[model samples]
Target chain A: MISPIGWFIIWLGILFDILGTIGLVRFPDVYNRLQASTKCVTLGTFGIMVGIFLLKGFSPMGIKALICGAFLLLTSPVAAHALMKGSLHFGTKMWKGSVVDKYGEDKLGGEQIEKEG
Target chain B: MRYVLYFIIGFCLWLLLTLSVNLDHLIVGVVVVLLGTVLFGGYFTDKPIKFLQIHRLFWFIVYIPVFIWYMFQANIDVAYRALHPERPIKPGIVKIKTTLKTNIAKVFLANSITLTPGTMTCEIDGDYLYIHWIWVQSELVDKASEIIASRFEKWLRRIFE
Candidate 1:
């Protein structure tokens, strides 16, 4: 059974998860959704992993949870960056409310090599 | 020496992951790390000794708490905007430059910006990092970079460089 503190942390993680999902659905554009889903989901999952570690203590399960959390932190931003770079290169328009487009301005109206990566 | 360092790091990672001090586990970990070091260690940093520097390790330990603090603040800020009816956001892309010479340092800087609230790194081109800002308070490149990357850069420079 999970301790009270562990349960609290788990609930916090679930709350973040819900907020991130709401952000994902309600955001106007792809980039905004990426920001919400990527950052929030990474933190939410990492929090859940931390909760699991606290519940299990220093045993194998807890150690595994920590490792999973570390990997999540390392990889989520990479995925987000890749998605954003692809979308921008393919000319996905920013929302009308967006204030500026520096990337578009500098690299504007130019064809990019598809297999650049 | 680099290979030895790689082997030791790999062994330590295995110990942490497996969390077992049994004799059999030790034997298997050593064998696996030996193979891994042989196959992949060459790609690791040329100056693996830098990893052993006391200041770097100390700063890294110190950085963890600061990062977590910023992350908490970011979540609160984003959560507020998400729950707000008008979504009081002034989203835009902005270009900022990092003074950190090392690519690894720049990578960490980019990752930190993305992980934090109000900013997401869209691209890194040499010294320049293009960011998607949730709230565009500053339009100037120097000002934006200062706001976005300077906090982490101060610590990362000492640790990585």
Candidate 2:
């Protein structure tokens, strides 16, 4: 039987996933929405994986869950990084309130506009 | 030596999670894992051994559980903000200065910050990290910088410095 904690985690995961979707919809810009989606969804997925592991015990299915969790953890951030880098490279403008543009005087000395791929 | 490390990590992880001691399963696992490691070794043969320091790997293992705890804590905070009716999100970007000098440590810190809920690493400029935080918990941007540097950077330095 799944423990109370496992059920709680599952519910929390669902709650967080829904919240992330809401943030994605409500956020004003691409960067903000990306932040909401990537961070919340990753944690939500992780919580669900942990709950599944607890419910399934140490069976092969649990092992598979762990593997999936690890993969998700490793790839999600990398994918987000790639997306951000690509956006920046493509000259996507930040929200007006953005405080800093550290890349404005980039050392690479590339052109103001990224070369079209 | 690299293959040996890979084999041991794979075997131990398998054993610990499976908690199995059957000789047949052990043999099969070892053979399959070892073969995989051999095939994988080709991908890293050009990289120097010093780059993947064994002692650093040990520290990384020691730090993972602590990192997970921090992640869980961040997850709860994000979930709370997300579920609250007020939505209480400031939705701003903050520049946090980092002390990690090496590229590896900087990459680790950037990835770690991005992985944690509610914060995203927007840009890594030398020792500065431009982060987009969903909720501005601290008024002082330095406070967030200190929090990340002290919590994850120290451990990452131990692993990679």
Candidate 3:
């Protein structure tokens, strides 16, 4: 049987995941959605995995959960970065309410080179 | 030395995966690890090994818990923003310059930023990292750096310096 603390942590993770899904629907743009999803997967899923590891102790299954958590930690951001890069490249407009856009400025210079050539 | 380090890592991974104590498993692990080290050990630069100094390793050990604490804080922060009806988020991409010189260190910083509160590294062009922040507190680079990475940058510097 899982400890109450373990169950609580798992519930928190689920709550974070559900919030992320809500952010996916509520956010104004791709970038915002990416932020929400990345954080959710990284924290929520890893939290649940850690809870499982705690519940299972040091058995092979427990160790596997730890390894999987590490893998998720390492990979999720890279995946988010790739998605963000792709979105930027495809010119998915930033939310109008965004306060700044250094990416736009950088891309403007790149565009000038494209126009000249 | 690098080859030995690779062999040790490979063997440890083998042990972890198999969770075995048999002599046969040990021998097979050694053989496979040796082959793996021979084949791919050259890919690991000396930089990582240099950062593996005892002092640096200690700081890295210390860094993990702090990182986890911040990660939890970040989750709550994001969760609050997501769940609130108003969404209370002012998103933007801000440029921040990192003094970290090594590619591996910069990569670590970028990954750390992505995992930390309210910031996701969008792109890195040299020392300048473009970060997508869920809450746009400041457009100034120094202030943004302070807000986003002051806690992590100091510790990471000690580890990677």
Arranged by DockQ with the best first, the candidates are 3, 1, 2
What level of docking quality does candidate 1 show? medium
User: What's the true lDDT of residue B36 in model 3?
Assistant: 90
How much is A101 displaced in model 1, in angstroms? 1.0
Worst 10-residue lDDT window for candidate 2 chain B reads B42-51
TM-score of each: 0.90, 0.71, 0.88
Off by over 4 Å in 3: A110-117, B22-40
TM value for model 3: 0.88
Greater lDDT among 1 and 2 belongs to 1
DockQ for the candidates, in order? 0.66, 0.28, 0.68
Encode model 1's per-residue lDDT on B1-161: one tens digit a residue: 89999998889999999887999999999999999999998888777778989999999899988987887778777888899998988789999989998877888888889989889999999999999998898879999988898899999999999
The C-alpha lDDT values of all candidates are 0.87, 0.73, 0.83
TM-score of chain B of 1: 0.90
Cα deviation in Å at residue A19, candidate 3? 1.6
**Comparing 2 and 3 on lDDT, the stronger one:** 3
After TM-score superposition, what is the CA distance of residue B126 in candidate 1 from its true location, in Å? 1.4
